[model samples]
Target: MSDTVDETASGAATDPVLQRLSTLDRFLPIWIGVAMAVGLLLGRLVDGLDDALAAVEVGSVSLPIAIGLLIMMYPVLARVRYDELGHVTSDTRMLGASILLNWVLGPALMFALAWLLLPDLPEYRTGLIIVGLARCIAMVLIWNDLACGDREAAAILVAINAVFQILAFAFLGYFYLQVLPGWLGLEQTALDVSVWGIAKSVLVFLGIPLLAGFLTRTLGERARGRDWYESTFLPRIGPAALYGLLFTIVLLFALQGDTITSQPLDVARIAVPLLAYFVLMWGGAMLLTRALGFDYPRATAVSFTAAGNNFELAIAVAIGVFGVTSGQALAGVVGPLIEVPALVGLVYVSLWARRFFRDAPSTDPAVPDTGATR
Candidate 1:
């Protein structure tokens, strides 16, 4: 329930956004890199480390991985202000754009890219589609905040996406992996996964954490107050999400280190499509919202929301559905790895693009103008 993290980020930016990050959050890529190295070394040097880690299992998930997955997701989900779902629902323009961009365009774009770019690599392709389907719940808030986007709007969009994900991710997984591929004459996933199977995994992994987060926020706020529950409590637990992410990454990479290290080109191959997806998604979202006359903050919020993926859930589902050594899990791990820097660059792009919006002068880190859009 309590832990501390040194928030960190890459590079030196005198911008307040960069300064706001703690050493831990700032150095996320570095941390993941180190974890990858440690895992690879462990896997390479220690004969039975992977086996030992995988030996203990619960409900088909290795105990260590299960712990990491839950710890990784719970805090992030708890931070989402689920009760505030109504706050931005009234903004039809913004909401519509986000819905189209996130649920429709976002996943479709990833599916196209994965298949088009890595047709020969079904594992990576399926993994990319899973990454796309997971959508952004936890990380988009940070990216939006970093870009000085709307807080309430970010929360609402993230909350909405999380709710839809529990129902839609599996169906989308089934569609992209099975139905769509078959229609396109592409080779489907080797594993015969079903919608219910994916749904069950989603329920256990995302549903448990989602419900736990809801109850925690509700009870914590009722017991204390909003300020204590958020300001006092959330920060302590928040760091564990990344820490848990790193823990799982280490184990996952450990299991597949030989493959990852031997075929460095595979990571590169995975990275190219991902890089294109982020840039295209973010840039396209920004332009679309701007064309729709959204203010800078709203545009930034919507753009980041559209661009980021829920890699935690994606990794969980990939490993759950495809097994740890599967390339799908490896591809899932590469998501946030590439996303971190890509979105950071887009933050600068967002800040720079402010001039294109009429509300450029209103770009302030606050709750945003809550006037209900007529």
Candidate 2:
């Protein structure tokens, strides 16, 4: 009976159908969108999402909040191969380029775009800048891997961004608050709770995952091969993490659904600056990568690093500090709506650009000529 049970389990685990489903697991970004659409549709049909959010709470924890943190951790932990840490120091140039673009150029462009275009909507303007300062802690690594980036380079860049954002984001938040016109009183209020609260959220969201990842590698090394650790275990966690995250997005959207519905004008209010930020950063990264003579993978990494925001962390922090009723929280909720789809498009663009750099490509190759003789 034991033998039969083991056989059944193994067969299920190795099923070809399951392997195919695993591909879907990798595309969590798409699932995230689906979750959002479904949640919004549900919220619309029902009265409001507030009760749903309230129902999801457990003690100090909410299911949505738990899911958000999980999503951030799983991606980072899965991609972090401790053996590859040695490679980071070697690929300093690519890492340097990513840091310069994501930290310096990305934040600066976002600040300018928000400042210039969103002066009227101070809360959302602050939210937009928060999105910018946070950088791409999780998604850019996925982009790097998809684009066939040097993993070492990508890891180094992610680690650096994670650390710097804690410090830089607080300062950037203060800076944005200070510069906004005195007429925008929301800035002063946001400035009051901003830095310290964000600092704590950073600690909870990033610190725990990082430590867990490191410890998991250290302990698991003796018991299992790295392939088993990654392919067998990490793959299982990927889908779960993404689903959790999207569910969180749903709750967040639901929480703000009524306000969003009532104030349709807010959509138009925030759209301009968000659209402008996306275009400017994407264009700037592509141009800068070209100027620096980076290959396709490195270029793709840079472009995404600049383009993507740490929306998971942003939403979690925004909700925690700014009330769920606040426009800042609403803006954080809106971020992934644009970000997920835009990134999928950017992934395709990166794949398309791959052909320019080399004769043979890893993902998809150009068709070879065939005679009509067949």
Candidate 3:
């Protein structure tokens, strides 16, 4: 079992598509920084462009960003094998732990960190809470695969998070941003958040892509066969999400370039809690996996999934609930900039941690050892 898993993972790691993706992930921070610089430069050179883009809004959501959001989310949602979600019931303990970590403990931790770290910066705090509320759905798969984690388990978790986000994100956003701050006696600005508005944003951002992805995969596979869809079709379109991500970042920073440049400290302030949140969540989840006696692959999957946030959804909702030029949106823009490098570093840490559990037995029969000591 372990050898078969090792062979499969090794083959995947060497595949051309994954290699291209790995190369992209390796220089992700550089790409983001370049995007920021380009956006700032454009913002300075073309004074009217930002205004023009900002003007194209419907119900607070920027049209260009909305398009980018849909493009970014579709590839991710399309890649998810929703049928595998049934496997979640077979591993109830892991599923329960993941849910607890992602929805409950994860959000609570970010709320505490945002408050503890940014007492005065209400907008930035709200941004952190928004990120916390939106759990991982897309990027965790890449992180998990890199760490030799159980891909099936990762897929199940991704599906679960996606469904949960559609259901709970708005209410949690309201609770944490509106009610909790008041209850905790923290000074908060009057955030005009409507549950219906948030629900609409989720539906537009996640729900539509989800439906489209489901239909695309179901129809495409039925027509062309699963092998061709997985190998040929998926690789061709998978990079669309990353492209959309970079475009969104450029547009976001282009819109808010002046604010970011003038108040550099504010960017740093938002980054601090975000950095802390990633490390804490990764560490906490790693320890939890160890406590649960999961093997290295399963442990890495749980830890990476818990550590990474669904920044795409967070950014969309931030722009929708707040405005494109709002400070909350700026903070949302800053999240992926901080997260990619941090999580990549944690990927290396996970590799090292794998050595410690290399000989440990897997609690779940579904996960094989994988001999993943690369």
- Per-prediction TM-score: 0.72, 0.74, 0.76
lDDT, candidates in the order shown: 0.73, 0.61, 0.71
Per residue, candidate 3 scores C-alpha lDDT tens digits across 44-89 of 6777877877788643556787787677767666765667656645
By TM-score, the best candidate is: 3
- By lDDT, highest first, what's the ranking? 1, 3, 2
Worst 10 residues of 1 by lDDT: 365-374
> How far is 194's C-alpha from truth in model 2 (Å)?
5.3
> Model 2 lDDT vs. the true structure?
0.61
lDDT (0-100) at residue 299 of candidate 1?
Answer: 86
The most accurate candidate by lDDT is 1
* Candidate 2 lDDT, 22-59, residue by residue in tens: 34433545776777677666666677456766676432
**lDDT winner, 2 or 3:** 3
True lDDT of residue 305, candidate 1? 91
Give the lDDT of residue 7 in candidate 3.
Answer: 23
> In order, how many clashes per candidate?
14, 0, 0
